[model samples]
Target chain A: MDILPQLILNSIIAGAIYTMIALGFNLIYGTVKFFDLGYGALTAVGGYSVFYFYKTLGINIYASIILGAIIAGIIGFIVYKLVYTPLRTRKSSGMVMLVASLGVLTAAQAIIAIIFTSQFQTLSINAGTERVFTIFGGVITQTQLITLVLGLGIMIVMALVFKFSLFGKAIKAIGDDEEVSKIVGINTNKIIGWVFFIGSAIGGLAGILIGFDTGIEPTMGLSLLLKGVIASIIGGIGNVYGGVLGAFLLAFIENFGIWKISGEWKDAIAFGVLILFLLFRPQGILRR
Target chain B: MTKTAKGILWVIALVIVVLIIVNVSSKGGKNSNTASSTPIKIGFTGPLTGDVANIGQNAKAAVEIAVGEINSAGGINGRQIEMVYEDDRCAGPEGVKAANKLINVDNVTAILGSVCSPATLSFAPIAEKAQTPVLSYCSTAPKISESGDYIFRDVPSDLFQAGFAAKYTYNTLGKRKVAIINVNNDWGLGLKKAFSDAFKALGGQVVLEDGDDPTSKDLRTQMAKVKSSGADLLYFAGFPDGTVAGLKEAKTLKLTQTIFGADAWDDNKIWDSLGSSADGVMYTRVGTNSSDAFKTKMKEKLGNDSIVYCSNYAYDGLKILADAIKTAGTDRTAVKNALYSIKHVNGVSSSLIEFDANGDPKEANYVIDIIKNGKAEIVK
Candidate 1:
């Protein structure tokens, strides 16, 4: 049976989630020039917030998702103020900021563990009523199609905003040279704060989408962050369009690479591609 | 040096001081002990921090409850069993240090724990050389027993649990084609191998095999492949973190199938992370909600507010060890012999617990659990 079409569809969906994380990570990394390890924690925040509101508090899932994204935006602003801003003022090295981010990751993970108590949970929306359709010898779920559409829509909107909006131009100017942008009266700090809020909202949306698609756990952020980082690095660090391209490329390679081997070798193939990129074009595909 | 570095150095110094005091006091106490009156001290080690800490803390609580119960029932041959707990940080080197401290400094007669198989493997040789009996409740690696007679595991190895889950996936869930995703670790590898063997033996077709580092973030690549594999089911083997994340991504990508796993998928942490996406996650684990003994004992032990599965197993493990000691009449050798001789002993989770020559429990049932509303309920 030819499952190529189904596989392509699935890869596109997976690529969408990766693009969400990559977009946020790339935005932050490009402008700040420091790894925001805490972005992963925000993903957890987004997932758990929706989980708590919908599953625990009995709120509607759609409402919970909006509430979760808003909360993540708030958290992103606070994290920028508390951690990144102070580090920036200190003229901290990238390594120092990286370490601080790791600390935030550890502390955030510990807090999650303390609150949720480390059990696997599921959203109960389609507990037993999922419908699957077979096309071209492969099966696809309705929920997956929705996620793919949502992801593509969000990416398109983000790309449009980046190309057209005044806020997006300010963000780009800040990324190019924070001092120069500040000299030009850009209010770089406030613009950066807004960037975090918007970027984290995207991350939260990714988290919510992931929750609907898979499941949520306290430690889910780490793997999500790794994928985002890989996607960003592969496509072009700090390049908005690059993340989407990178995610799709990564998905296609991984999906098709395991045709002759056990699927277990899929990751090795992905990492091998990553290594090749690292060795040949350390600047990444788009070379921002 | 930087302020943070200076602070870290001070903390390290303080920890060293505390360790020195503990070591010196333990040495003095051992010397002061009258040869005939020395209590049989036992050391228990595992993570007391981080995500899996709940597993260790519950195990520790169970040990405490069981120790108190056995001591009240009159010590193993009138010799009080004393437990000394340590945090292994779930790492190999820390686990070895914990074992050394227990053996050389505390002079514990036997040691329990060092949860998570990697840590357990590190402490195995140290315990064996010290001639201390080490019974692990958390380590599930099949090779843990190969460290020799000194090592005993209360929980059935992943071999049995993973195989059973794979069989259930094929015969019960009706999954013909499956994809295997495992973490890069002993626990993950062992379970994957076991599942592969059992699934193939049952005539199930495995379409793909994928490995992910438990700590990595981007799983979309591997997940996308699984989605496109045309498989009927997905099997993830790892701690709850990776399993939950992978499952959630699979859901996002619209990869629909029955997801199966081993005991690591049993934690509530997975639910906290996965949220709504966690529904329908299937895994095999020691039954958490089946037997009356576990429920009743847990209620009596932790009250209704804190009943956990690991605690019940730990409590049962302690009871079993104490029973063997009592049945053997005070000698450690006799206790070991009696443990082997026993054909059937009721456990907190089982109606009958019997060990074979390899010390593997016979008729051991790994209950299949389906996640419902963030909790795992026994399905098969």
Candidate 2:
């Protein structure tokens, strides 16, 4: 049986995850124009929250996921109300906002460590092997298939939100020109707060999905945030659709590059792709 | 004076008063005892923060527990064992600084750790210059001990673990074709080379090799490519975080087959994270200490069901140091001599830990453990 299709399927699955993380990350970056290093930490929060709800509180996993998303959204709102909102009101420079985000990242990470004690934790209800499925000579797991479906569903919903919703127009308006958006009677501050909420909640969903796929640790967010940022940068910064496309492209390049060589070169291939993109198409495939 | 400046001055004065009081109390203990009766101080340095902090924390915890037991057993030769803990943060420069602190400030006679091999190597030169013996619990590279007389390892190096992992995958698992993925670091690179050599020696074909930057998020592409490579099993030589992430992504894409890794995969968290997906994933580890003595000791101390192998090793490292101190009569050359001549010495981890001339454990074997019911179970 040909393994190429299976590898392609796997790469697509990975791309879906990166898309989710990058989509959320880019939303916040587009609105705030500042990097939130703590975006990854929010994912950890979502994962830990779900773990607590399902494993510790004995809630259903689905219920825990909803609760985790809400918790992440609430935390995002707080980040705005407590840190970002005040700083923006104060008319802080981009660098100051960047540093504040760093503070948030460090504080959020430390809180997770203190709460979870940095132990590797997972939520598995049963002792059973993973079920594998094959289609068209390609193999995959049931969980993975679910992830791919969920990713597409989320992407479609986001696309519709951006296209048809009034709030989406305001966001796009702000993305184009924040001052003009405010002058045109768009509640820029309120819209940005909502953006943080939406973006962070999505980030939280990514975290929960990742926790189910891998395990959750306090520091897992940092790496996730890095990938999300890379995908965003590669896809076309500040563009949701572009970010998703970039994530898939990134996944495909890394997965396909090491077709014959040892798996150890996978990451090198990823960075090489990034460097190639930076060198040739710095504006990205879909520029704003 | 401005309000803030006055406040700062007050805080400084308060700090000075506390320091004076502490110094006075500390001096009282010294003045009451003869200078010749001071305890022999040893140092343990390892990463207390960052990604691999858990490993170092376990090592530190084990050392504390073991050293506590030693001191209670009436310190070596009437000279009490004093230990200094350093947070090396797993960096080479940090390791050097930690070693210097132990030597200069703590005045330790020997040094026990610096968890990663690079960190251990960083401190080895300093220890050799200071003429202090160094025993490590986790640093597994073979070259770590090659620096000379002062450096030793408590466990077998990665050379043995990787070779054994490769041999087991080829012979026991009966896999002819394998694809290997490793983290792009010294630990992963070194282990991969060893495993590659051993796997080839066992007449197995390595179809694909790929590396991941620990910080990289997209590995599905490489994993998918491996699925197409027609490898029977996949091996990942990296930490628990990356291993779980990669395996989960690989599974999602339906590249299902047997997966193998080394001691890096023995983490309890990895199994829990993967849920049902973790089942049938096989990894290797130095056999767990299932002895009654180990159980009793763990029950008395940690009160945890999953007895970590690293923590046990750390505990053994401390006990060995303590034994050396006692046998040597002074925390000086005697402790080092006792450690080298250690014969049939026992600890809670293993029934017997007899160090060879090169400071390598005489007996270290790889046991294949499968993820069953979210916990590792011995397959053979």
Number of the top-ranking candidate, with DockQ as the measure: 2
Off by over 4 Å in 2: A123-133, A275-280, B1-34, B46-62, B86-101, B163-178, B202-204, B215-236, B246-260, B271-283, B287-291, B327-338, B348-357, B362-380
DockQ of each: 0.22, 0.39
Question: Tens digit of lDDT per residue, candidate 1, span B87-187?
Answer: 88666788898889987777666677867888888988888776677777777887776766777777778888878887788887788998888887777
Score every model by TM-score.
0.78, 0.86
Scoring model 2 with DockQ, what do you get? 0.39
lDDT by residue (tens digit), candidate 1, A121-177: 555464324566666655556656666677667778877877899887888889899
A1-288 in candidate 2: lDDT tens per residue?
Answer: 576776677677778888889888988888778888867789888988998999889998889999998899889879988998888888899889888888887899889988876665554454224576777777666556676777778778877988999988889888888889999899998899898888899899888877765567777787678777778888998887889988999888766676666555765776777788899988778896
Q: Where does model 1 exceed 4 Å of error?
A: A124-147, B1-40, B45-62, B84-107, B114-119, B138-140, B154-188, B191-294, B302-313, B323-380
**Model 2, span B1-380: residue lDDT tens:** 99999999999999999989977765644232224566667789988875567677766767776777667877666667777889887778899999998876666777888677778888888887877778887777767657667677777778888888787777777888888888876677888788888888889988888877765544665666677678998888877667766876666665666888877676666676667666788887776454566556655665665556777777778777766765665445566677788764455556677777777777775678898766788886
The weakest ten consecutive residues by lDDT in model 2 chain B span B27-36
